[model samples]
Target: MMESMISSRIDIIKPSGIRKFFDIVTQMEDVISLGVGEPDFATPWHVREEAIYALEKGRTNYTSNSGLLELRQEISRYLATSYQINYKPETEVLVTVGASEAIDLAMRALINPGDEVLIPEPSYVSYSPCVILAGGVPVAVPTTEKTDFRLTSADLASCITDKTKILILPYPNNPTGAIMDRENLIDIAQVLRQHNILIISDEIYSELTYDGEHVSIAAIEGMYDRTLVINGFSKSFAMTGWRLGYAAGPEVLIAAMTKIHQYAIMCCPTISQYAAVEALRNGMDSVKRMQEEYDRRRKLLVHGFNEIGLECFEPKGAFYVFPCIRSLNMTSEEFCDQLLKTERVAVVPGNAFGDSGEGYIRCSYAYSLANLQTALERIGRFVARVKQA
Candidate 1:
């Protein structure tokens, strides 16, 4: 009886596939987890210090519904300097609980019932469910290893229907760590130009890009007005626990999202907002340091996976590596489960992201080199045993 009372939307979506393995890891001993995408680094010292200082000063009052003006200004300045896209702090930016909240807000504010949202799979697991909750149909456009997992112009053009309303562009992608370069975006933009779809560019991993500078689709000519840029301090500044992110887009959309935000969230954590102001103002150097370390680990894991016979692609952004496991003749879940039980290493199965990811597994390099090295050795043994079997 109680189950029937729950919303149909809530019932239809499965629990996060990432969390399912993580929960099992928590119950086991000696598991080296490369499953979660969170930064292994702590929030940068200065950012944490700012949060402590804010608490001491008793600045715990709720910020305006849109967010603290100071943090918004810093976000505006950071975007301008980093991505060459400009948004007015006063009207075009909305501070969200995290990029997660910004994503939900964008979906809720834009999606009408039956409107379709295009999501490229394998992607972060949230996109499809969020669209469903907001009464939108999610249309998956599959991308492959052939294109480095990018959503190509042909793919985008092929998926569009008259009902399609929004396209979620999650680059420096979670689970895959694939990034779309400027040339890639230019091609995607050319196709989007003929359509009237709005874009929600989830750029939370923007600062973690390893090859060249990260480019914002919003920065491309004729794309800015139609794109909602979502970014936060989590990945770059290692401020995942801070729960601060922002959305920059047109004033009309920002206002709509803010209205929903005001009713649902009221405001982001006050101390976190304050800390984020410092993160944007004084955090780039720390970001560069972390990026450098991630780059080192990235190379280590890619080489290790390939050496172990799991065809791994070199990721140019983010800290995860997606390695193909089809050669082992087992499913992604079967490989991950057996590896965890036998070798005590936890990595997410590729199918957790989407069906297209079924033959791959995502291993995060965010772990320490020592832990990663050990995990790689364990995985190597597991792969050998599986092959022998």
Candidate 2:
């Protein structure tokens, strides 16, 4: 193979830091994994049943380039009902493989070479990589524990430049579980409105919010036109394997995304589309039940960490708890590695999310309370030993 055989585009980037530790865990036995940000719940029975019915009926063919119209319409209605944001199913929505694909589509469709994408630090691992792969420059704007990992307008404004093209907003954020309320969004919206930057708001964890309702920045005044709201059924409905997600945005952007999606994917899995329809229609009760369970785990983990001397911040949304491990006198990676090797509990190093995450580690509370209880006990022992040394 020639030196240039691999695209320089891909050669420049690094593999996900989240997966590095996870890969090690796969070969280990009796390890309790709090690393991956996946819901441990099975897909709701009704949602699974719907997918089975679709397969039984041989609904295995490809959908329209955008998606099954019925699924899109249901997504439209669900967003309207939940977030007060209206997205026309016909022209403003396009279903993709997952919110990951939706994020890529939005970036690729909107970016030009050398365009800067403002990404807040300690965000989902994929955001900056996707921006880079889309030929956009990823400018990481740091957010700190001092602000509960919330990206303030001041932080965002400081990074904007003449070359900035997009803002990747990942609230109900992955590692930190930080959320921006309506007032926080309004302040950020005010700053965004002054610039020509487009907003790619990844709200995949929207349904998992614990405090007030999840507010879409797209719903904020002056943001609708400039925002591409990315959401999907993976996190909310525990349908990660279903690979179904959709993007709601301006017609022109949607059209561009659909064009790329058509060429790249043609359509999402037809059976999954049917199941997503069921999810948006009749799965709210199931979602609520899961959310309630996650709330319990969230509270338990937050309190347990604080009590055990890790000093965790209370996360208002999502299933992960980020605990400050700086007192242990180790880097995030060293803390995670030592904990996993010694106690058989796997958690991700916070720096895997970004530089600002250096003093912390991300542990998902999506596991059962029993598993969480055991993991915490082991972690407590590990923390005590580290502190004494």
Give the number of the best model, judged by lDDT.
1
| lDDT by residue (tens digit), candidate 1, 1-389 | 99889988897677876676667878998788898789999998898999999999999899999999999999999999999999999999999998999999999999999999999999998899899999999999999999999989999999999999999999989878899999999999999999999999999999999968999999999999999999998888988888889999999999999999999999999999999989888888999999999999999999999999999988889889999999999999889989999888888899988999999999998889998999999999999999998
Q: Mind giving the per-residue lDDT tens digits that candidate 2 earns over 1-389?
A: 78768889888698765676667788999889997788999999999999999999999788899999999999999999999999999999999999999999888898899999999989888888888898889999999988888889999999999999899899999989999899989999989989998999999999999967899999999999999999999999999999989999999999999999999999999999999999999999999999999999999999999999999999988889999999888999899888999999999899988999999999998899999999999999999998888
User: Which residue segments of model 1 deviate by more than 4 Å?
Assistant: 15-22
Q: What value does the lDDT take at residue 57 in candidate 1?
A: 100
Clashing pairs in 2: none
RMSD of 1: 1.1
| Every candidate's lDDT | 0.93, 0.92
